[model samples]
Target: MVGATEEARLNQLETQVDNGGGEAWEYLCLVRKLKARRSEKVLRHGIFILNSHIARSKLGGEEWTLYEQVAVAAMDCHRNDIANDCIEALSKKFPGSIRVGRLKGMLLEAKGAWPDAEKIYAQLLVDNPLDQIILKRKVAIAKAQGNLAAAVEYLNNYLETFMADHDAWRELAELYISIQMYKQAAFCYEELILSQPTIPLYHLAYADVLYTMGGLENLQAAKKYYASTINLTGGKNTRALYGICLSSVAINQLTKGRNKDEKDSADLQPLAAEALLKDYKERAPEKLALVTAMLRNIKLVS
Candidate 1:
């Protein structure tokens, strides 16, 4: 079932169509926008819109765009026959077109034809080596085949040419984490933090990686990043709050019997502990005892 917002939007689109006020291009554009937003109803609506007489009459120059859109929607919906028909139509209209070729490649990918998809993407790359889309396709193919190392290699090479791609950097960081390469993951998150300083996700991820790499220095660093995450999120991030408590406890344990200067920000533990207890007391009363017990076990509370 579609959510309330999606149901409302679908109703509005249908009302426009019924009243003859919806232009084919406008309908298609709206459907494409919904698809980009990951609306679950888009596949059915997209296919229906493409087949409507209104769409047929109005998509004179936008015909190929509608075909591509429906092709992708059909592929996602597992309607391979519809996808094939759309791809064939596009191939005939725009012969030797890289965009059409990429669609064909994606179609093969949906059908699990890994080798054939790779070949098509390879040829497309040769035609345009700087194609970011084709490079990402190669990474997807590697991941689909469960070849993490190959995926990493492809992404690293892609980053060599396109270092500013934050999405690619995040993907690389996740791939590194999956393979237990925390140091490499930390490096990727650092790059992401440098590129997008205001994003709390990068700060949180960097803190987690530093915590995983566990040492006095890394524990201290993780505590700092976790605190940054809390600040960026205005203390709404439960994970960041927990991260502060954990990292602070670890740092205090590591710095035991050391100079006061060596203790770092171990003083933040009680504040974090208080925030956590207060959050649980107000929002999750049922879990308050469990949280309190946990805080006590970690020596963050009495």
Candidate 2:
């Protein structure tokens, strides 16, 4: 986040704490929260708050959720320089504590610094082999970097390590769709559905790939999936499910080249396309539009 000098200063503070040190972060916490300048004096409190959270986080040989929260706060407040500086400094100060590496990695990954994030995560894995959190982060980095084979491999490992890994299966399914490996993606969704079918997005995602690959025969299955998803999701997310259903219906129309409305074949395509776009927008915040567009493109105009 910050340049060399600030990172060094933060490291020094953490080192003092590590060596049977002081309540520096606490003392600064009481400082005046007045001006918003980058001076060492003003930034010290922020640094202290950041480190205090980190110190509290390192109590056990465990995951440091508090430090993760602190780092996230720094990033969310556009204080990445402070967060990064804090992370780098703490790593040196508390070399025995994996909290520094883990929290820093979490912050970096959240901010889209996948390469650097992956490096930190790799270090954490070496320290704690059974850390499901780091394993998930590794899968995420592989998936985002388009290393689908790697993602698939790591997820398989995650399964062996964690039996109750519902989210891991969900992420695996999503990655399959991301790489356009529809059939495999569908299977992944099916596996997750076995555990948690109530999430509407999972059903929608499953229906999408089925529709993409199976043509007309798949439409019936897709519709069925959408219906189940609707029932499971309930009215709380009704609009979102409706949006996904509309997109699925639009895809079916493309494959069939006509709607259930037998009256106008030529007029159907553009209308279907428009409905797909509308539903996608109404789906609260998701990548349904991108998925819809991709499905729309894999067609034969004949």
Candidate 3:
């Protein structure tokens, strides 16, 4: 009892399969579209189509690819029988395929068999340590098992080879933060800022780390970076707005009794922060006002 829209989609795919006119990926495309929709009911439509196609001889070597996709979808739907069928067929056809091994690892992960999943990913890495997908899976398994230390080690090794992966850098930074290692987290954010200077998130994260470390020098640095984030995002960033405000207050406190030269040097920053906060409040007065209310507990004066 598929809906009209999905029934039409299935009919279209069926025409493609029957006429042998769609691209090689027609079935795989259907499986992925259903997966993306994330509806188990709609996903069963995909399983039916795959089974219909599987019973025919019209599909060729590409059918193995179809099996892999269906297997993944089957796992998502918790249809272990269908998934096992696809896996067994794929394993028999390509007994030594690393891609198939990955699918098997994914199946184990789906079943909450973390150690088995990790073992499979580790063996895949041993065969090809540079495989980004396998490396990420290994890291993910480590993190899922609450083994942050092992996850950090794997991520560091991954970045040693793939330094340009901003997501990996961000993940490693978060892991460091969870362990109360602000210095290490700051290093990760620095790497992210170096690679993606225009992104406000990296700037905000780095500013947060520096603000947490809290010294005259770190506060000044944090103030400058928070300002950068505010400017980069055109004042839509509330976190940057709050960051600049707090850093300004903290820096003023730290520099209160310094010499005239040092005071003069530090005075420019609070002015800059005040100006940014002014613009932010102008654009989002209610939000800034609310944030200010929340900040009252800290005894921040205005």
Candidate 4:
């Protein structure tokens, strides 16, 4: 389900439990809430229901599943004692299960044991070469160890197998940006824009990359993307508006006294700059000076 529907379902479950519901109702409700997202509601109510129904009352039916979920939720909430207890129970039940082994790796990861976590993930990959979850965890482990190049290599291999994953593409783009690889970052954003045209952030990111690349053709493409971002978000994006101003100035500088379209395209820079200046002055006063400096640099206003 979508975010709104999931939140609504969680809210409904919260309402049901607050009305003095039964054990089964409370257990299902809290588990569903915890599985959806890590919130204070999950940390508090998950512990409560697990202690009462699962521990004290000795609830059955998918007990192992509950143990795994509660272990993860507890770890996320910093309740290591509860998490350890759940892990102990799960290990006893499924001694040789790779799923349980992955949880063990997660527990090591939570404890800052990077080498141990990577070892576990690597062994898991050896057993099942096509396991996407294990490969992704290996990439995460590399990133957590501050090995960006290794993370990038592993992520590239992972994406080769899972080409349609947008989240992986976004993560790859961020990694490229971290290394100052603007061309690679732009390629990632291009893929994102191709897959999700309506997502304004991808258009803005692509525009920012092109603007940073800084050539006549790149600046023109940047200007077009910035315009698309402004249109997509109904001009609510201040950065894209400023991007239009900056990219137009760069393009006009490159093709001075040659292209009439440069003049026509740059006509909106003054209006966009003025409107953005007013917005920054009112909403983000600290940014007003930067806007003023940019407008003066572009000769859009005195």
Highest lDDT among the candidates is held by which one? Answer: 1
lDDT of 3 at 145: 84
Q: For candidate 1, give the lDDT of residue 260.
A: 80
Off by over 4 Å in 1: 1-40, 257-259, 262-264
Ranking by lDDT: 1, 4, 3, 2
Tens-place lDDT digits, model 1, residues 228-248: 999999988889999999887
Residue 69 in model 2: shift from native, Å? 2.0
Each model's TM-score?
0.88, 0.53, 0.71, 0.82
All candidates' lDDT scores? 0.85, 0.61, 0.76, 0.81
Per-residue lDDT for 243 in model 4? Answer: 91
| Backbone clashes under 3 angstroms, per model | 0, 2, 0, 0
- Residues 197-226 of candidate 4 have per-residue lDDT tens digits of 999999999999999999988998999899
Clashing pairs in 3: none
Determine which window of 10 residues in candidate 4 has minimal summed lDDT: 22-31
Task: Rank the models by TM-score, top first.
Answer: 1, 4, 3, 2
Model 3 ranges off by over 4 Å:
1-45, 54-67, 73-82, 257-289, 292-302
> Tens digit of lDDT per residue, candidate 2, span 93-121?
68857766677787787678998998887
